[model samples]
Structure formats: structure tokens, C-alpha cells
Target chain A: MIRRIAFNLFAWTIVLAVAFPLFWMVLTSLKPQFELFRRPPTFLPETWTVEHYWTLLSSTKFLTYFKNSVILSTTTTLVVVAIATIGAYSLVRFRYRGRESLAFLVLFTYLLPSVVLIIPLYLMLVQLGLSNSILSLVIAYTTFALPYALWLLRSFMAGIPEDLESAALVDGASRLGAFRDVILPQLLPGIISTALFTFILSWNEYLYALVLVNSDSARPLTTGVMNMLVSSFNIEWSLLMAASVMMSVPLIIVFAFLQSYLTRGFGAGGVKG
Target chain B: MAEVVFKDIVKSFGSFTAVHGLNLTIAEGEFVSLLGPSGCGKTTTLRMLAGLDFPTSGSISIGNRVVNDVAPGERDIAMVFQSYALYPHMTVYDNIAYPLKKRGVRKADRAPMVQKTADLLQLTELLRRKPRQLSGGQQQRVALGRALVRDPKVFLLDEPLSNLDAKLRGYMRVELVELHRRLGRTMVYVTHDQLEAMTMSDRIAVMEGGKLQQFAPPNEVYREPANRFVAGFIGTPAMNLIDGTLANEAGAWRFASPGITLTCPPLTDDAVSGPACLGVRPEDVLLGEGPIRGQVQVVEQTGHENIVVVKIADGIRLTGRAGADHVWRPGETIQCAVDVSKAHVFAAGPSGQRLNRPLTKDQPRLAKEGA
Candidate 1:
């Protein structure tokens, strides 16, 4: 009994350790702007104010950035999730000659850091006349999110047996018809979590959007917040903290709905496509 | 209803052969089991009949229509899987109605069809529940309802009841047999369990090492096995195989084994004088009798039957069955007589062909392999 209690306490400590940064972000956002850098870092704020939120909302292009982030990330996430689910289904159900090679490429391409390809991608977008446009970011975000979506979805699809789909086929339904009727419905949970992950990853992306989009028109919340922090030298800690808090809301809503799928069902975590 | 035929069917995976040059015909409305150990290609044969697989070297016909390159969806067949493969996302009603809906059955028509099937399978009250909410038996009934609603040309069952507990398995076996009788569609079932093949099939096709050894009615396969393989595989506690030789004494044939000689029977005129393996069923041992003597090493009583293990003179351990109430002390001197009329002689060659015929000519036809 004592051993079990100690193990649970250790687990909770690990959880708190990981969650410390997000809690600190929220706490620091509530502190008054004047006392933001106080001495030994007081645990609780001496004074609380909405001055940071007002500063971010009234002066910066934070609202426009927030809107662009919502639109571009949501669209890319939806497209990546839908395409990845179908791609994973094909990889699981159909056996082709280069099956292993194609699967290896999926993981390999996922591991290829997007930072290495930014120069070429930026030039390609400029040639396509898509630079500094939401279309380019939408396209870039999909590239970043799709491999992980495909890999994780492929792992989830493995848990669902081929027998379920074949049973539908032999019951006078076409192969595609069986996939729609029998397979797609069971993958709802995994797909939701995949969507959530893509949305969050795209939401928080800054380097590519900064390098690819030069204007405020296509800038997302992360790039926008960094610009506000870098404006005129000294760090605007309170306003930056407010923007950070605002950026994580959409993901929290998505994660709440997708918790079960990410944690159970297939029990396959986010490493595969 | 349709009769399915496999003409010279062969299936290979890359360089490995799963089934080789197989030919079979299932009569209209007949229930035949493809019986074998695992990986012996029984399920593959059933899948080919369902048009889910392509034969490498031969043709398959269902109801006189050759379906060599047909897709599974185009074939009018239904298969029940061992996992009960119900769509966990759909309600029981939608699951049963899914096939009907796909074939463009109107909303009004699909309901009654699903209803009729549910009523037949006794799944009336559980229509609104999803498959994940049902127990294992209920999920099986739902799978059957989905197949039954189609009214397909044939039913392909791949070890459907294997996942259930023994009692449920027994109950489902009877229920499935009755279901087959009522529907009367040609059903091709697969199972590795010998007793299942014995109790549930009109004809059992025994397969070993990717070859069809024997295909016959249950009692015929039991009473007159075609070879040493079939003889030893068909019975409970298995047939006791003892090495012996044939001798003719006083114009009656006798089998001479170590410390015993038992008589008498006559073989066919083509019989050769040589070593043979004699087969006797464990239940045929009449304990405490004439020609054979042994010491009982151990006894097991399972409330309905007793299995007695004894050591004979040839240093062979033979198992015999007795009644439940009887007592058998360890190391007890027990005398037993094995029935001579039920004796079987297998060829000394590796083929293990039988040397006699006690019944109609077609009962055991193993002497004709590779002819």
C-alpha cells in the first residue's frame, strides 16, 4: 500500500513539472505591468489588472493575427486530417509492391525538419505568387501537419481488423462502400485527436510564417506576438503574456473533445502516420 | 441457393504454396466443413469460394457461373468471421440493414427486412444499441442477422463460434445447425476442432499439410479411415496404433504382437506378408478379458468416463476408457481383450495405406494416391 501511494505521488509530481510553464504563463499574464520583473519572483501577483489585455487589443495587430491563425490553422488541420485518414486506410488495407518503402518514406519525410526546406519553399511560394498570402501559410501548415497525421492515423487503423471491412464487402457492398460504412466511423476518435494536434502545431508555428510571410496580412498569433515583443527594444512582457494566453484557447477546446481518442482506443500515441 | 465448385484451385503467396491443385464441389443447400489444423489453407479455400481471393491456376464457379476473376462485392455471398466483425459504430438495426441499404433497398423496405432478421435471431429489443454494447453472443447473432438479411447465394463461415465459452459454443453450434436448416443456403464452414467438424457438417473434408486427405460423412470417416493419418486423427483419446505383423494360423489370419497373438480375420487377396501398424480404438478395449494383459499405471475418472493408462509387454503405453464408477488402482494387474473384428492394418510403406475393405468399396479409398 505504501509503495502504491509513493508511485502515485511521483506520477502527479511529474505531471505538475510538465504543466508548470503553462501555469506560469497564465499567472504572469495577470500581474500588473509595473511589477512584471519584481525581485526574487513572488509566487502571487501583488496587484492584478486588465492593462495587458487592453494594451494588446488596442495597439497591436493582435486581432488580425488571431483571426488569420484561426482561419489558416483550422483549414489546414481539416484538410490534413481528412487526407491522412484515407491515406492511412489505404496503407493498412491494400498491399502493394513498394508498401514497405512507401511506409518508410512516410516516417522519413515526417522526420525531415521543415526548417531545412524553408528557403526552397519560400522561393516556390514567391514563384507561385503566393508569398505573404494566407494561401502559402495554409499550404505550409498542411505540409507540416500531414506526415504526423498520416503516421498516427496509420497506427490507429492497424488496431481495427481487416475482417470488419471484409465482412461488409462479402455482404453485397463494394469495397469503397464498405470503407465508408464500416471503417470510417470507428476512426472518429483518432481522427479528432489528429485534427487537434495539427491545429495546435499550426497555431503555434512562428519561424516558417515569419520567413515566408513578410507582411501583417498573413501573420499568425505566434509571429504577431513576437513582433510586439521586439517592437522598440524593451520586452512588453504583460502584453506578450496576454497574447500567449489567448493563443492556447482554441487548442484547449479541441483537446477536451479529443482526450479519449489520444489516450485510449488504439492507445497508439502521436509518433506514426 | 447455389452450388460452389473449385476446379484445380491453387493459391500461392510469393514463393510459398498455401493450397495446391485442389478441387471440390459443394452441392446446392449442402453444408460442408473445410477441416484442418491452422495454416493448412482451409480458410483460404473458403475465401476463394466467396470470391475474396483469386486462384492462381484454376477456376471457381458458383451456381454454374464461373467466377475466376470476380470481385468479392460482385459475388452473392455472406461470410461470418470468427471475431463476429460487427460495426461497433452503428446500432444493431443499422448494422443489419447496412447491406440492404447499399443494394438500394428503400428506407421502407430495409426496416422490415432488418426487423424480420432480428426477429428470427431473437434480437428484437436490442435494435437501438450499438455493437460495443452487446455481449459476445448478441454480437454473433447480429452478425448472423446481417448475413441472413442479404439472402445470398452462399454463407461462408470462418470459425464463427470459436471465441465463445464452451457452453455458449455448444449452444451456438446447435443454433447454427438449425439456422442452416431453416435458411438452406449452401454454407461452407471452416474449423480446426474435430468434434465440431464431426457434429456440424454434412461432410467433413479433412486437410493436412495442404492436402485433402479424406472427405466423407462423419461416421464413415470414423469407422473406416482411409489411411493411418485419418484413422489416428478421427477418434477421441485417439486410436491406439501398435506395431505388429500378420500371420495365417489354422486358416484364420492372426496379428502377432509382443507377448500376445490375437485372431482372426482375412485380408484382401492382394495383401502382402510384411510389417504393419494395427489400429484399435481406446473404447474397444474390454477391460479384464482374454488375450492381452497389462499393468494399469494410472486412472482418471471425469464423472462420466474413466481413462486408464497401462503399460503393455512391448514397452508401449496405451490409454483405454472405462466407466465412471469403476475403480482402477495404480500398478494393478489388468487383463483386457481388444476386439479383433475392428482391427485395421496399415501398409509398412510410408503411405500407410489400408490392406482390407470391410464395407462398400468407396468407404476408404487411400490406395489410389498419385495414381
Candidate 2:
């Protein structure tokens, strides 16, 4: 019993060590401006305040950046996940020459660094007259997000038994009908996890957002939050912390609701029947 | 019900031919089993009949209409996969109703059909439960219910009972036979178990190495195997085959081996005097009181009988069945006799053709008595 308690204590210490930055961000976000720089730093604020949050909502372009981030991330996630699901299904199921090579090529694209493609993507977006817009960010994000999502989903698709589809076919369903009725429902857990991963990837992405979009109106939270810290001569640490705390709320909510499917999805992939 | 036919069907996967030059005509309402070991193309033939696969050449027909170009869904057949393959997301009712729904049956009409099928399979209480909620036997019944709900003209089953426990397999065997009797639909079953094929099917098609070895009723297959492969494959404690030579001695036929010689009964005109294989089932070998002598090697007690293995010569063995009451032990010298009336002679080598006439030409009479 004593050994278990000591082990648990050690485990919790590791957990707190990892989670300490997030906890400090939330605490600093709630502290008053003067309290942030106090020589004997306080664990709890002497004067607890929402003034940073209030200013972030009303006095700055924080809401505009938040809205842009939401639109850009959601659109990129939906489009990438939609295409990846069908592509993964085809890669795992249908028989044709070069199918395996095509799947390999998709994974190969993921190995290329995002920074390497940013200049070409910027030029293409500008040529298409989509520069400095949320649309450009969505396209830029797909370059990295699509390959990752397809590789993850392809393994998930391979985990389902081929007998199920053959049974559906002999039961009088067309090929597409069998896919809709059998494959899609079975693929729901995988789709949810892939969508969540894509959403979070787009939500936290920085490089393409920095390189592709320059106008303040279309900037996402990554650049928008950085602008306040870098562009200002005197930094408001409290407000920056408050923005960090706010940026993570959507991800926390998503994680809470889909925790089970995320574990199941990861467990099912790459495991043969 | 419809008659199913395969005419010169050949299936090739690139350069490897899975099935070769197959021709079969399954009569209407007949339950035919394609029996063979693994990789013997039995399942491939069933898949071709179901339209899941198309033959590389030749044609397949159902009810006298060529169905080579037809889609699987339009072929009016249902298949029970070896895995059961129940939709994991759907309830039993929805699983059974899916095929009807695909055929555009009205929802109200579909309910009665599905309910009737569920009731027939004793699955009424499981209508609302998903497949994962049921036991293995219950899942098997749901698979059957799904296939039965359509009332298709033909049913294709690929080793459906192979996954069941031994007791359950035997029980389901009877249930399937009854189901076939009631439905009277053409059923093509694939299995490697000879007991299952012999007990359940009206006719058995024995295949090996992508070729049909023999196609006959179970009794005919047992009594008169067309080749050595069938003779060796179809019996439990398989028929003991001894290498020997047949010779004609002054209007008498004699079979001679290393340690023993036997005078055989009058054989048909097809019997040739040359190297041959002598096949005798254990049951037909009398355990004691014969001219041939040998020492017992091992005795296996099977409650009702003892399977006795005797070494007649160096590297030559013969298995004989003895009554359970008569105890025998290993290393005991014994005399046994071959019941020549029921013995079989085949040409030399593996897959040799049967060279002697069957004891009785009573296949049709036996079939009539069986019915």
C-alpha cells in the first residue's frame, strides 16, 4: 500500500511537471497586470481579475482573429477529411495497377517539411488572386493535413474485414450502396478521430499562416497572438496569457467529448484481424 | 427453385489457375456440397456461382439463363460467409431487412418477412440487439436469417459451420438439413469435412488440385470412389491402401504383396493384370481367423469398436476394425482376413483410377430408399 502511494505521488509529480505550463498560463491570465511582475511571484492572484479577458474581447482585434481561425480551421478540416476518407477507402479496397505506389506517394508527401512548400503555395495563391484571405490559408493547410489524415485513415480502413463487403454484395447491394451501409458506419470512429486531429492541426498551425496571409483582417490566432507580443514595445503578459487560455478552449471541449473514439481509433489502426 | 450450371468454367489469378475446366449441373432444389481441402478451388467455384467472381472463360447459368455477365445483386442468390459477416452497426432486424430494403420492399411488408425469418431462427428477442451483443451461435442464426429473409432461388454457404464448436456443429448440421427440406431452394455448400458433406448433401463434388475428382451421391462416393484421392479422403480412419500386384492364375484372380497373398472375387472386365493399389476399409477387415498372419502394431479403442493396426511385412501396415468386446493389444501376433467382396482395386500411383467394378449397382435404389 505504501509503495503504491509513493508510485502514485511520483506519477502525479510527472503529470504536474508536464502540465505546469498550461496551469501557469491560466493562472497568469487571471492575475492583474501589477501582480504579474511582482518579485515574490504569487501562486494565486492577490486581485483576481477578468480585465485582461474583457480588454481582449472589446478593445482589440482578438475577436476578428478568432473568427478567422474558426472559419479557416473548420473549412480545412472538413475538406481534407472528406477527400482523405474516400481516398483511403479506395487505397485500401479497390484493386488496380499502381494502387500501392499511389498510397506510398501520399505518405511520401507527408515526409516533406511544410516550410519547403510555403513559397510555392504563396505564389500559387497569389496567382489565383486568393492571397491574404482565409481561403488561401485553408489551401495551404491541406498540403500537410491531407496526407497525414489519409495515411491514418487508410490503416483504419484496412482493419475492417473484407468479408463484410462481400456479404453485402451477395445480399443484393450495389458497390456504392454496400459502402454507404456497411463501410461508412463502421468507419465512424475513425472519421471522428481523423477530423479531430485535422481540426487541431489546422487550429495550431503557424508557418503557413504566417507566410501565406499578411493582412490583419484574415490573420489567425497563431499570428494574431504573436503580433501582440512581437509588435508591441511594452508587452502585456497577462493579456497574452489570457489569449493563450482562450485559444485552447475549443480544443479542450473537442477532446472531452471525443476521448473514447480517439483511443479506439488509434488502437484499431495497424492491427490485423 | 432454379437449377445451377457451370460449363467449362476456368478461373485464373494471373498465371495461377485456381479452377480448371469445371462442368457441373446442380438439379433444381438440390443440396450439393463442393468438398475439398484448402486451396482446392471449392470456395472459388462457389464464389463464381454467386457472381462475386467471374470465370476467366466459359459460362454460368441459373434456371437455363446465362448469368456470366450479371451483377451479384441481380443474380437472385444469397450467401452465408464463413465469418458470418453481420453488420456491426445494425440491429438484427435491420440486418435481416437490408436485402429486402435494397429490393425496394415496402417497410411494412419487410417487417413481417423479417419477423418471420427471425422467428424461424429463434431470434425474436434479439431483434433490437446489435451483432456484438449476441453469442456465436446467435450470430450464426442471424446470418442465416438475413439470407433466408430474401427467399432467393439459390443459397451459397462457404463452410458456415467451421467456426462452431463440435457439438454445435453437429446440431447445426441437422438444422441446416431441415432448413433445406422446408425451403427447397438450391444450396451449394463448400467444406473440407467429409462427415459434413456425407451427412448433409444430396450429392458431393470432390475436388483436388483444381480438378473435380468425382461427383456422386455420398453412398456411391463411399462405395465406389472414382480415384484413389476420393477413396483416401472420404473415410474416417481412412481406407488402408496396400501396394501390390494383380495377376491372373488359371481363370482365378490373385493379389500378392510382400507377406501375404489373397484370392480376390471375380472382377469386372475393366480389371487389368498389373501393378495396382488394394484399398480396404477397416470395417471390412475381419480381426481374426483368416489365412493371412501378422502382428498387431497398435489398438485404438473408440467405445463401439477398436481400430487395430497390423504390420504384415517390412514397412507395410493394414488397419482393421474389431468388435469392442474382443480386446487386442499391441505386439500381439494376429490373423485377419480381407472381405474381398467389398475390397477395391485401383491403378498404381497417386490419384489412380478405380480398376474394379463396385460390389452393387444399387445407387438409384439406395437413393430411393434414402428419400
Candidate 3:
């Protein structure tokens, strides 16, 4: 019993240590700006206030950035998951020349650093007259997200038994009908996990957003929040924490709703049997 | 019910031939099993019949219609996969109803058909449960139910009961035979288990190395195997094959081997007298009396009988079955007799053909009388 207690205490300590920054962000966001930098630094807020949150909502472009992030992330996730699901299915199931090399090429693209592709992407977007727009950022996000999502989903698709589709075909379903009825339902947990990863990746992405879009109208949460809270003269600690907490709320919601599917997806992808 | 035929079927993947020059015809409502060990092209043959695969060169026909170009769905057939392949997300009702839905059956009419199948398979209560919730036997029944619900022209089962426990496998064997009798649908089953083929099929097609070895009734396959491979493949405590020489001495045919000699049955007109392999089932080698003598090497008891392995000479052993009433010990010298009428003599080699004269209509009793 004592050993069990010690182990539990040790485990919680590591968990809290990992979670401390997040805890501090929520705690500092609630604190009045005066309480943020106290002598010893208060563990709990001495004066809890929502004025920073009110200011973030009412005065700043925080809501605009929030809206932009939602649209950009959702669009990127839907588009990436859609294309990756079909692409991954073809890579895993179909017999064709160069299929294996095509799949390897997808993974090979993922190996290339985002910074290396950003220059070419910027050139391409400018040539298309799409620079400094949300459309350009969406295109930019697809470059990294598509490959990652496709590679992740390929293994998940391979995990599904080919016999299921054969049984469906013999049972009178057409090729697409078999995919819709049998493959899709079985692939739901995988799709959820891939969509979650793509969503979070797009949401937290910084490098592409920094390089692609410059105007306030198309700025996502990453750059918008950084520009709003951090300035040339001073850094607004409480307001930055407030923006961080707000930025994480959507992710937390997504994680909460799909927590079971995410764990199942990861577990299923690891071992075939 | 429909007749199925495969004419000169050949399936090759690149340069590796999985099946070669295969031809078979199944009469309407026949239960034919394609039986062989793994990598023997049994499943490949079944897949070609199911339209999941195309033959390199051949014509496949069902009910007199050439169906080589038809899709699996359009072929009016259903298949039970070895894995059962139940859609993991659907309940039993939906799994069985899916094919009907694809066939564009009215939704209202589907329930009664599914219900009747469920009733036939005794799965009424499991309609709401998912496949994972059921036992292996129940899942097998659901797979059969799915195939049966369609009333297709043919049913193809690929090692459907292999995943079940031994007792469940035995039980499903009888259930499947009865199911076939009731449905009267042409069924093609593929399995490696010789016992399953022997117990369940009307005729067994034994395959090896991508070629059909013998396609005959189970009794004929057991008693009169076509070649050395079939003789060794089809029995428990497989037929004892002794490398020997057969010669025509004046009028009588004689088989001679180290420390053993026996009179041989009459051969067909084309029989060649030379190096031959003698095949005798363990039961046909009667223990405790005759002209041959050997030392018992081992005795395996199985309640009803004992499989006695006797060393007749150096590097030569013959397995013979004895009644369980007698307890025979290793190293004991014993006398035995060969039932030559029931024995098979094949021309020497792996693919050596049976050289026994074909049994005529009145010759079966004559052969037994000679035994």
C-alpha cells in the first residue's frame, strides 16, 4: 500500500510538472495584471478578474483571429482528411505500377522541412495573386498537413481486413458501395484521429502563417495573438496568457469529444492483430 | 440451383503459376469441396469461381451462361470467407440484410427474408448483437446466415469453420451438410482439412502444387486414391507407402520388398511391371496372423484402436491398426497379414499414378471376397 501510494505520488508529480505551464496560463489569465508579477508570485490569483478577457473580446482583434483560426483549421482539416482518406485507401488497396513509390514519395515529402518549402510556396502563391489571403494560408497548410495525414491514415487503412471488402463485393455491393458501407464505418475512428491531428496541427501552426499572410484581415490566431499581445516596447503577460487559454479551448473541446477515438486509433495503428 | 463449369482454367501471377489447366464441372445442387494443404491453389480455384479473380485462359460458366466477364455481384453467388468478415460496425440483422439492400430489395420485404434465415440458423435472438459479442460458432452461423439469406445460385465457403474449436467444428460440419440439403444450392467449399472434406462433401477435389490431383467421391478418394500424393494426403495415420518392386511371375503378380512379400491384385492392361510403391491403409494391415513378420516399434492407443508401427526391415516401417483389446509393446516380434485386395500399387515416383485395375460394377464384391 505504501509503495502504491509512493508510485501514485511520483506519477502525479510528473503529470503536474508537464501540466504546470498550462495551469499557469489559465491562472495568470484570471489574475488582475497587478497580481501577475507579485513579489513571490501568487500560486492562486489574489484578485480574480475578467477584465482582460472582456478587453480581449471587446477591444482587440482576438475574436477576428479566433474566427479566422476556426475557418482556416476546419477547412484545412476537412480538405486534408478528405483527400488523405481517399489517397491512403488507394495507396494501401489498389494494385498499380509505381504505387509503392508514390506512397514512399508522400512520406519523402514529409521529410522535407517546412522552411524549405515556404519559399517555393510563397513564390507560387504570389504568382497566383493569392498572397496575404486566407486562401494562400490554406494552400500553405495543405503542403505539410496532407502528407502527414496521408501517412498516418495509410497505416490505419492497411489495418482493416481486405476480406471485409471482398465479402462486401461478393454480397452484391459495387466497389464504391463497399467502400461507403464497409470501409468508411470501419475507418471512422481513424478518420477522427487524423482529423484531430490535422486540426491541431493547423491550429497551432506558426511558421507557415508567419510567412504566408501579413494583413490583419487574414491573420490566424498564431500571428494575430502574438502581434496583439507582444509589441516592440513591452510584452503583455496576462493578456498573452488569456489569449493562450482561449486558443486552447477549441483543442480541449475537440480532445474531449474524440478522446476515445483518438486512443483507439493510436492503439489500433500500432499492432495489426 | 445452377451447374458450374471451369474449362481449361489457368491463373498465373506474373511468372508464378498459381493454377494451371484446370477443368471441373459441378452438377446442379452438388456440394463439392476443393481440398488441399496451403499453397496448393484450392483457394485460388474458389476465388476464380467467385469472380474475385480472372483466369489467365479459360471459360467459366454458371447455369449454361459464360460468366468469365461478370462481376461477383452480378454472378448471383455468395461467399463465406474464412475470417467470417462480418462488418464490425453492424448488428447481425444489418450484416445479413446488407446483400439484400444492395440487390435493391424493398426494405419492408427484407425483414421477413432476414427473419426466416435467422430462424433457420437459430439466430433470432442475436439479431441485435454485434458479431464480436457472439462466440465463434455463433459468428459462423451468422456468416452462413448472410450467405443463405440471398438464395443465390451458388454458395462458396472458404475454410469457414477453421477458426472454431474442435467440438464446434464437428458440430458445424453436420450443420453445414444439413444446410446444404435444405437449400439445395450448388456449393463449392475450400479447405485444407481432409477430415472436413471427407465428412461433408458429396465429392472432393484434392489439389496439390496448383493442380487437381483427384476429384471423386470421398469413399473413392479414401479407398482408391488416384496417385501417391492422394494416398499419402487423404487419411489419418496416412496410407503406408512402401517402396518395392512389382513383377509378373508366370501367371501371378507379386510385390517384393525388404523382409516383406505379398500377392498383388490384378492390374489394368497398361500396367508396367517395374519399381512400384505399395499403398495400404493402416486398417487393412490385419495384426496377429499371416506370412509376414516384423518387430513392433511403437504403439499409439486411441481408446477404440491402437496404431502399431512395425519395423519390417532396416529403414522400412509400416503403420498398422490393431484392436484396443490387445496391448502390444515396442520391440515385440509380431506376425501380420496384408489385405491385397484393398491395397494400391503406384508406379514409382512422387506423382506416380495408381496401377490398380478399375473396379467394375460386379467386381466390388469380388474384390471384397478376395480380401
Candidate 4:
């Protein structure tokens, strides 16, 4: 009992240490302007106010950046998942010349650092006249997300028994129909987790979004928050903290909803009958 | 409902031939079992018949239509897998209804069909439960229901009851035979269990080393095995084979082995001589006062009967069954009579072909000699 208590105590300390910054961000976001400049920063706010949120929601371009981020990330997710699922399924069920080479290429590309490809991707998008637009950001993000998503989903697909689809086929359902009615339903958890991972990665992606898109209309939350810091010499710490908290809310909600599937989906393809 | 035929079907994976130029024909509504040990290509042949695997050469026809180029989905056949591959994600109702749904059956039409199948398999109350919720037997029935609901021309089952417990497997065997009698579909069942094939099939196609060793009724396969493998594989406590030679002593035919000799039936051409293997069933040994003598090595009483293992010359063990009332003890001198008329002589080679003897009219002296 004493050891358990000690372990709990140690775990709680680490958890608090990790969670303090997030708590302070939300706490500071609700503080009035004078409290921010206080001599010894108080752990708890003496008085809570919504003025920073009001400024972010009503006066600034935060909502626009939020909307752009949603559009950019959702597009990336849809394109990545659709392409990767087909690529992964093909890599799993079909055998042909170069099948091994193709699978290896996916893993090799996933291991290649995205930083090395960004410059060439930027130049390609510029040549296509798609720079400064959300389309360019969507395309660029999908390129980086595809390889890893394919690798993950391919392993999951390999776990599912081929007999299921073969049984379906011999029952008079077409091959594509078997894939739809049998394989896809079993892949739901893995597909959702893959989508969630790609979405979060695209949503928080700063480098490509910053380099490819410059206009306020297409600027996502990552660049939008960074713009605020550099916009003036006097950075409104309150506003910045509020925007950070606001930006993290969607991701937190998404993770909360998909957390079970994320862990379960990764463990699924290891051993099955 | 329809006959299936495989004309010279050959399936190979790269250089390894799983099945070699197999030709088989199943009559309409005949329950045929492809029985063999593992890797003998019985399942591969069944898969080819189900259109899951394409043969490297030769043609397959279902109801006289060539299906070599057809897709599995278009083959109009259903298969029950060894794993009973019921869709785990779907409920029993949905799983049974899926094949109908795929064929574009209206929703209104699907329910009644599924209900009838569910009732047939006694799965009406469990329709809402998933496959994981069901027991092994229940899952097996669900798989059968899924296959039977389609009313396909042929039903291919690959070790369908192998996963069940021994009691359940025995019960399912009877149920399967009854089901075959009721449905009368051209069913091709594949299994390694000889008992399953013997008790359930109308005819058993015994295979060994990727070749068909014998295709006959179970009793015929037991009584008249075509090769040494079939004879060795078909029976429980298996058929006893002793190496011997056919000898003519003083113008009378006799079978000679070490420390034993018996009068043999005359060959038709009188050409079956030299080395041969003598096969005898355990039940054909009458345990008392006869031409063969041995030392009893062991006695195994299995409820109603005793399996007596007797050691003859040079440590050769011959097993014979005795009634429970006959008490046998180890190290006792036992004398048994060989029912020579019920014995078999197989050529001493890999083939082990059964040698033919002259008819009763030509072998009148043999009966007189026995008397």
C-alpha cells in the first residue's frame, strides 16, 4: 500500500508538471489585462473575465483562420484516406511484379523527412499558380500524410483474414462488392484512427502552411497565431494565449472522441484467426 | 441439384504441384467426400471447384457449363470453411441475408428467406446475436445456414465440423448426413478424418500424395483398397499387412511367411507369385485353435470388445479384436485362426494392387481343402 501510494504521488507530480503550461494558458486567457503584468504571477486568477475571448471572437481574424484550418485539414484527411486505403488494400490483397518494390517505396517515402521535400513542393505549387491558396496547402499536406497512412492501413488490412472476402465471393458477391460489404466494415476502427491522425497532423502543420499560403483569407490557425505575435512590437499576450487555447479545443475534442479507436486500431493487426 | 465435374484439373503453385490432372465427376445430389491427410490437395481441389483457385490446366464444369474462366462470385456455389467464416461484424440475421441481398433480392423478400433458413437451422432466436456471441456449433450452423440459404447447385464444406468437440462432431456428422439427405445437393466435403468421410459420404475419394488413390463407397474403399496407402489409411486399428510370398508346395497353393503358412485361393492366371503383402482385418481373426500361433503381448478392452496385440516370429505384431467375454492376458500363448477367404493379397510394391483370384467354380478344390 505504501509503494502504491508513492507511485501515485510520483505519477501525479509528473502529470501536473506536464499539464501546468496548458492550465496556465487557459487561466491567462481568462485574466484581465492588468493581472497579466502582475509582479509575482498568481497561480489562480483573482478575477476572471472574457474580454480576451471577446476580442478574439468578435474583433480579430481568429474565426476566419479557424474556418480555413477546418477546411484545409478536412480536405487533407479525405484525399489522404481515400488514396491510401486503395493503395494499402492493393498492396495487401494483390500480388504482382513490383509489389514488394511498391510497398517498400511507400515505407521509404514515409521515412524521408518532409523538410527536404517542402522546397521542391513549394516550387511545384508556385509553378502551378496555386500558392497563397488553401488548395495548395491541402495538396501539400496530403503528400506528406499519404505514405505513413498507407503503411499503417496496409498492415491493418493484412490482419483481416482473406477467407472472409473469399467466402463472400463464393457466396455470389462480386470482388468489389465483397470489399465493400465485408472488408470495409471490419476496417472502420483503423480507418477512423488513420483519418484522425492525418487530420491532426494537417491541422497543426506550420511549416508548409506558412511557406505556401500568405493571404489572410487562406491563412490557417497555425500561421494565424504566429502572425499575431509578429504583427506588432507589443504582442498582446492575453490575445495570444486565448487563440492558442481556442486552437487546441478542436484537437482535444477530436482526440477525446477517437482515443479508444486510435489505441485499439494500432493493436488489431498483430494476431488474428 | 446439379452435378459437378473436374476434367484433368491440375493446380500448381510455381513448381510444386498441389493437384495433378485430377478427373472427377459427382452425380446429381451425390454426397462425395475428398478425404486425405493434410497437404494431399483435397482442400485445393475443393477450392478449385468453388472457383476460389484457378487450375493451372484442365477444365471444370458445373451442371455442364465450363467454369474455368468464371469468377468465384459468378459460380453460383457456396462453401462452408473450416473456420466457419461467418461475418463476425454482422448479426446472424444479416449474415444469412447478405448473400440474398447481394443478388438484388428485395428487402421484403429477404426477411422471409432468412427466416426460413434460420428456422431450418434452429437459429431463429439467435438472429440478433453476432458470430462471437454464438458457440462453436451455433457458429457452424450459422455458416451452414448462410450456405444453404443460397440454394446453390453445389455445397463445398472444408472440415466444417473440425473445430467442434468430439461429442458435437459426432452429433454434427449425423446432422450433416441428414442434411445431405434432405437437401440432396451435390455436396463435396473435404476432411482428413477418415471416420467423418466414412460415416457421412455416399462415396469417399481417398487421396494420397496429390493423387486419387481410390474413389468408391466407404465400405468398398475399406474392403478393396486400390493401393497400400488407402489400405493403411482407411481403417481404425488399421489393416494389418504382413510380408509374405505365394508358394506352390506339392501342387497346392499356399501363402508363406516367417513361422506361418496358410492355404491361399488360386490366382486367376496363376501368375501372382513371388513377394506380396497379406492384408487382414482385425475382426477376421478367430482367437483360438487354428493355423497361426503367437504370444499375446497386450490386451486393450474398450468397453464392449478387446483389441489383442499378438507377437509372432521376429517381433511382428498382429492386432485382432476379441469379444469382451474372452479374457486375454499378456505373455500367454495364443492360437488364432485366419479366415483365409476374407483375407487379401496385395502386390509388394508402392502400388499395392489387389491380385485377382479364380472364380468359385475354378476353385472348388480350395473349399474342399479348407473343409
Q: Whose TM-score is greatest here?
A: 3
Per-residue lDDT tens digits for candidate 4, residues A125-237, read 99999989999999998888998899889988887888888889987788888999888877877799899999999999999988898899999999987896557567889
Off by over 4 Å in 2: A260-273, B246-254, B263-275, B361-371
What residue pairs are clashing in model 4?
none
TM-score of chain A of each: 0.89, 0.93, 0.94, 0.93
Ranking by TM-score: 3, 2, 4, 1
* Every model's DockQ: 0.38, 0.42, 0.46, 0.38
**Estimated TM-score for each candidate:** 0.88, 0.94, 0.95, 0.90
lDDT of 4 by residue, B161-280 (tens): 888999999999999999999987889999999999999999999887788888999988887777667888889888878888876688666777885678775544533669987777
Candidate 3: tens digits of C-alpha lDDT, residues B201-313:
99999999999999999999998899999999999999999998988888777788997777677786656778998888999887888767899999999999999999888
Docking class of 2: acceptable
Candidate 3: misplaced stretches above 4 Å?
A263-273, B248-253, B364-371
Instruction: Candidate 1: count the clashes.
Output: 5
lDDT of 2 by residue, A58-162 (tens): 989999999999999999999998999999989998888999899889889899887788888889999999999999999888888999899999988998888
Candidate 4 local Cα displacement, residue B258, angstroms = 5.0
lDDT of every model, 2 decimals = 0.81, 0.88, 0.89, 0.85
State each model's C-alpha RMSD to the native.
5.1, 4.2, 2.7, 3.6
Ranking by lDDT: 3, 2, 4, 1
Candidate whose lDDT is highest: 3
C-alpha displacement of A170 in model 1, angstroms?
1.5
Candidate 2 residue-wise lDDT at A246:
94
- All candidates' chain B TM-scores are 0.90, 0.95, 0.96, 0.93
TM-score of 1: 0.88
Name the better of 1 and 3 by lDDT.
Answer: 3
